[model samples]
Target: MKGLLFDLLFYAILIFACIYVLPNYVIQRTIVDGSSMADTLMDGENLYVEKLSYRFDRLDRYDIIVFYPYGRDNTEYYVKRIIGMPGETIQIIGSDIYINGEVLEEHYGKEPIADPGRAAKPITLGDDEYFVMGDNRNISKDSRDKYVGNVSRENIGGKVIFRVTPLNRFGPID
Candidate 1:
């Protein structure tokens, strides 16, 4: 009876971690805070963020990521898509995004950017910097804004893998 009780207790702890702790730490969930990523990730939708990937893999262009606006300890967070990679020149002219003088071909931007803001002029990213922007350019406060600026590698928390809520759209994110 003693041996059986010990085994049951161990299994229970393992099950608890697999169901709760692992998902909370290794792969956390975040709710879309705003319409910044409209059409791509809707506001209030639940999405899974893979924390392990950021530690082992490198970030690529167009990958949706979540980060703290001020720092990792801050409560306010923002989700945006990578636009300009490390050491690349980024600029926006007449609602079009140009990377190193070449116009980027992407269908993610929901509408033509009306206000270029700080990115209206050419800005070069550092080796450790990445420029990000929201799909809904019109109202997004992203890298284009002076305060948001370019995101460093450490500031990025994780990649948003997929939407888990709103049953109809449950699947991997594009």
Candidate 2:
């Protein structure tokens, strides 16, 4: 009876560890801390990032993503939208984004940003690089900042698949 009880306890612990810990290896949780994605995503909102989404498919424009800021802590991550794709030349003039010399049509910003800094320059992305920016251009610390430059494809952690917190706002992230 003693041996049987011990075996049962061991298996119970193993089961608990597998069910709880294993999922974390594939999925992660994050909270929006700033106004970078304002109007699109609010601050303090809880989100689920799918770490495995990009392995099989190429990331698309306007796909909100989480990636590490270059040269920053590996565990530190930032969320932004893909504005420029591989091999594309991107330029920001006033409130408009010019891609390959054509103006991009996006309706997420509330107002046209006047000062986009160096991100305003026409930059041609590399084969494995992506240009990102925050929906709240006036307040987000994004690719326009020299410190948080273009993110490498490998640095992209995952896609913001859903928002799970603030019960009223729970739904698939657009």
Winning candidate number (TM-score): 1
The numbered model that scores best in lDDT is: 1
TM-score on alpha carbons, each prediction: 0.90, 0.86
Q: Candidate 1's residue-wise lDDT over 49-168, tens digit each?
A: 987867687888999999876888787889999999999999999989999999999999999999988889999999988999999989999999999898988888889998999899
lDDT of 2 by residue, 47-121 (tens): 998877586789999999989986435678898999889999888887888899999998876568867777678
Error of 2 at 25 (Å): 4.0
The lDDT per prediction is 0.91, 0.85
What is the alpha-carbon lDDT for the whole of candidate 2? 0.85
Query: Ten consecutive residues with minimal summed lDDT in candidate 1?
Result: 50-59
Q: List all candidate RMSDs to the true structure.
A: 1.9, 2.9
Candidate 1 backbone collisions, by pair: none
